[model samples]
Target: MADIAQTRAAPLRHSTAGALAGLSLAMLVSSLGTSIANVALPTLSAAFAASFPAVQWVVLAYLLAITALIVSVGRLGDVVGRRLLLIAGLTLFSAASFAAALAPSLAMLIAARAVQGLGAAVMMALTIALVGETVPKQRTGSAMGLLGTMSAIGTALGPSLGGVLIAALGWRSIFLINAALGAVALLAAWRFLPGDKGSGIDRAEAKGAARFDMLGTLLLAATLAAYALAMTMGRGHFGGLNMALLGGAIVGAALFVVAEAKVASPLVKLALLLRDPVLAPSLAMNALVSTVMMATLVVGPFFLSRALGLGDAATGAVMSIGPVVSAFCGIIAGRVVDRLGAAAMIMAGLVLMVAGCVALAVLPGVFGVVGYVAAIILLTPGYQLFQAANNTAVMADVDSSERGVVSGMLSLSRNLGLVTGTAVMGAVFAFAVGTKDVATAAPVAVAGGMVFTFAAATGLVALAVAIAVAGRRGRIA
Candidate 1:
């Protein structure tokens, strides 16, 4: 009997391992799609004989597609079947990658990328939702952390990998590599991931759920796209077009809320979603924390190059440290969350973020590179802790039917925060430097800008900590 039991359990263990590997690859491919093309932009420009702005569309198209369609696709998975949708998405991504690699014109390449982004939106949303099904309850945090680590690795590896591939086989090789990876990810997902048992959603679990909320999805997608465009246009300068788009986004948001309220089956359950103490605060804090984190990405390069007088290579090296640290810390943070519980770890992470922000604000100016590295070491680990715990808290108890939509919302919040940071934080830095062109600014001015931007970031993280504390108190009450 003991031998039989051990033999019986062996396949389950292998299945679990294979499932996790599939999910990790899904995350890695989606994130790699985001960062890999960025490094090849210049090469693409020269190849196509296009201006910088035109080539910029290659990246923007993918981002816009994901931002606009992610939530809809997630809700669609809930209505249809996550397993089926994920398989289709992976196939689409792989095919699109191949198309992108063979494109002879810039427009075709951009179109292919948009299609790829649609596929990625599905992968990103469903990957989180499927995690609940794949792992035991006790190991959820560890799984979430592992996913986080893969995301970090994809992000960190993209530029270096893209550079090597572009140099050896040309810019088209980047997309080819993604195509190969996507094919493997698709196979793993198909073979290892649990199949949908007659449409994935249980009728009892999804009471009152009707057909997919097409109207609400459309309204929300348009609003998000407008907002994304408003944030990104004019190269960080808010122009008349940006203002108009921003106004449109605000109006569209109001329409979406009203539409969702009236719809029998809404894309999002606004009341229940907002009312959940853990979920609401986690989403809010995720946005705030992501905004703060993006500040480092946007401001660090300029500060290192201008203020610290580092060359391009040295600046790149210093900037790579944050992602490298995040990649390693993700699993550790997850295990800690599992041990200490999500609630406690969330607060602990916030506290560390506050300290890290403060350190970034002060230490870099005084101690230079050493101080910057120290601040990053503190900040990156804190982010990993918060991410793992927050994701665990949100998804741990989510209803089976609602998981996909909720996961999409989580990704949406983080993306919005990143977009906001790029525009708002960049402006703040420029204003602090007292110049539009930061490259020409004096070292002292650049350093002052760095200090000012990080000072604001510190306050932002402190605010997040306060929010976390209040949420915990309310939960206890």
Candidate 2:
């Protein structure tokens, strides 16, 4: 195996700082795009004279495109050059954003969003891989932390920024803003990013001209698309179509596994995933923790609005605290992880998350807003720490040559967690409250449902804690 540690060049012409800045900007743009369009759904429905289901596709289409294409694009980056792919993705993303802004019809806008998703997928798949290639081994944790910070900030700001832009300049302004940001990112990437001449594995792969695993790639994409569709459509009802999609996803996944094992150069190295002691556990922990965290995000707003009788503005204000805390904590987590190692940080983070869930479950009605704020503070930093540290741990063991696919797997875990969290938690809330939507349920029902939800989330966190504990004997890196 080619050792990534031995293969990395000293540093790029612009150094680690410049590369980080460019990558961070790219990550921010991609993260922002994920949730920014959500605020415009109602407005889009009115403008296009479309029904709710049609307008909802504006969000669903983007998400599905990203989920389906991310892994394949990541593998492509490893074959070509990461820097080259980043530049191309940034340019394509910026152009797509421009097209979206200028869209004359809803269909055009949706198409533009799909293209944007593809571009975003490329960028997302490469961010960690590029960082691994650029940053020194000793400081990888810090770089991952900074990247996580930017992602948190972008995700936190997306909805608020979208609302503000839509209010000031209309929904098109959101894409216009993304275009401007994407342009800046593109310029920075072009100026700061080094060529892949330094990456021996990329060069070797190019020379060998290995056949791309089209069969495995297609199976993986189909599996993810079917799974995402099942989860998205299965929210309200587990009807025949949802069941069919779910079955298709299972079949596709099983086929993908078999195809990957036989392919000369598989889209995903199933053997690596199973054999790597650190990487597999870290990925599993990330997925589980993300599931718990996203469940909170999905239900917290409802708890604030219905149970506590808070308005949109107040709820938004309260909700902003978590991301704000997370951003700052991410910055701090890097240095701490560098000193204490990822396992320590992960263990601490899991403890905090479990505590926060317990607080939310038990103290919300009793302590009121204070308890909610406390829970947010705990969960925010907890998640930030876990994300930055766990990423560092995952990358530590991966060969530089394999970073692309590994990074894609990490990203896939998070996306899967989000989809699963929303579907499962929503179902749990519905079952608890005897309603399809918790938002419309009575205050008492909402409160009871939230408690039940948080209690369930706490159990998930406890499982994560057990994983962290079992893996704690070894050093993270």
Candidate 3:
């Protein structure tokens, strides 16, 4: 494991609070980009006279674009300059948002969304990486926690906000809102962010002519696109096409590895990922925890509506609790991590997640919605703690030149986990219910599936705990 650096670049001379605000808004808008359009999909389908599957691409295009381009853009930031590139990203995002709002055709909207996602990928990657330059080392956890809070707020707010906008003004209002917010974020960034002292890359590294690996970047993007499509296509029903794409992902991954190994400056350093105890385990735990979190999103609603017999409004309200709790708890979690240290807080967070999962597995069946809410109360804070601590642990020690790429990797791992959870955890729940059509499954079966899915989530988090412990031990060794 690499030793955690006590410091990175010198702290910014500008107002730290303002810089944090800019970063927080950047995180918020990017996260909002992810969830805001989801609730508007049906509205879009009707408005565009498109099939549900075609409208679904409105969401998929954004996600696929981000997943494909995030790391490449991160690497681009390291080479070109994070601050300059981020400004460009913000401009692109704002323009793309307005474009989406005014798009005359469904095809154009999807294309605009794809471009918006490219901008989001840059924002999401550089925000965390830039933290080192914005804040003092001692407050890293707190800054991370604040960013997490903003992200949770965005995710929690998006669906409800989009619903309201669509009802009052129409679907296009959502994109218009994003355009407005993107403009504000861009202004904040331009006015408050620190100047790039060394342009992200070390002067020595730049002098060495560290070039971007375009082939490696393309191979990785293609591989990730294949995997994302495989996991997402067919609406959770893995078919022949999904299987073929999955195979393509595997082969592409192999080729990517080969290309990366031989590249003069790889997008990702294979040796660093393989040998860095902290980075490797951190990425794994992030994916695992994200998968568990997604289970709550994918499976919780089913359990609430079918098993508990909640109405649509009631289900949505109850389902919003986790993100709301996380939004509030994020700062507190960061404080705790700052006090307890990232490594220790990690174990503590995982323990709480395990407990939360176990409680969910049995409490809902025994105590109903109250039990579910209680379990979430326990789980959400744990997630905030883990997210803040895990991010801090990974970013605190990374080579300064590679911060952008590392941040991108962290985001990518979480996204991959969500994609996996949507497919794998959903399948697990459906299998447990013993039904192809979960919407009409018996209440008892839905409850049973809830138990099974949360139980699996427990095991996954427990494994993450083990990984955290091992990483700590490796650090000590």
**Order of candidate numbers by lDDT, starting with the best:** 3, 1, 2
Look at candidate 1 and give me any clashing residue pairs. none
Task: Give the lDDT of residue 118 in candidate 3.
Answer: 96
Clashing pairs counted in every model: 0, 0, 0
Per-residue alpha-carbon lDDT of candidate 3 for residues 1-477, written as tens digits (9 for 90 to 100): 233342333433477898899999999999999899999998999999999999999999999999998989988887877877898999999999999999999999999999999999999999999999888988999999999999999999999999999999999999999999999999888888987767545642764536778998899999999999999999979999999999999999999999988877788899979899899999999999999999999999899999999999999999999999999999999988888899889988899999999999989999999999999999989989999999999999887778888999999999999999999999999999999899999999999999999999999999999899888899899
Task: Write model 2 residue lDDT over 391-437, tens digit each, in one string.
Answer: 88888877656777788888888888888888888788788877886
**Tens-digit lDDT track of model 1 for 1-477:** 999988864422327889989999999999999999999999999999999999999999989988898888888888778878998999999999999999999999999999999999999999999998888889998999999999999999999999999999999999999999999999999888886656445542366775778899889989999999999989878899999999999999999999999998889889997789888888899999999999999999999999999999999999999999999999999999999999889888888898998899899988999999999999999999999999999999998887888899888888888988999999999999999999899999999999899899988888888889999998899
The candidate that wins on lDDT is 3
Error of 1 at 325 (Å): 0.6
- Give each model's whole-structure lDDT: 0.91, 0.85, 0.92
Which model, 1 or 3, shows the larger lDDT? 3
Q: TM-score of every model?
A: 0.96, 0.93, 0.96
What lDDT score is found at residue 81 in candidate 1? 81
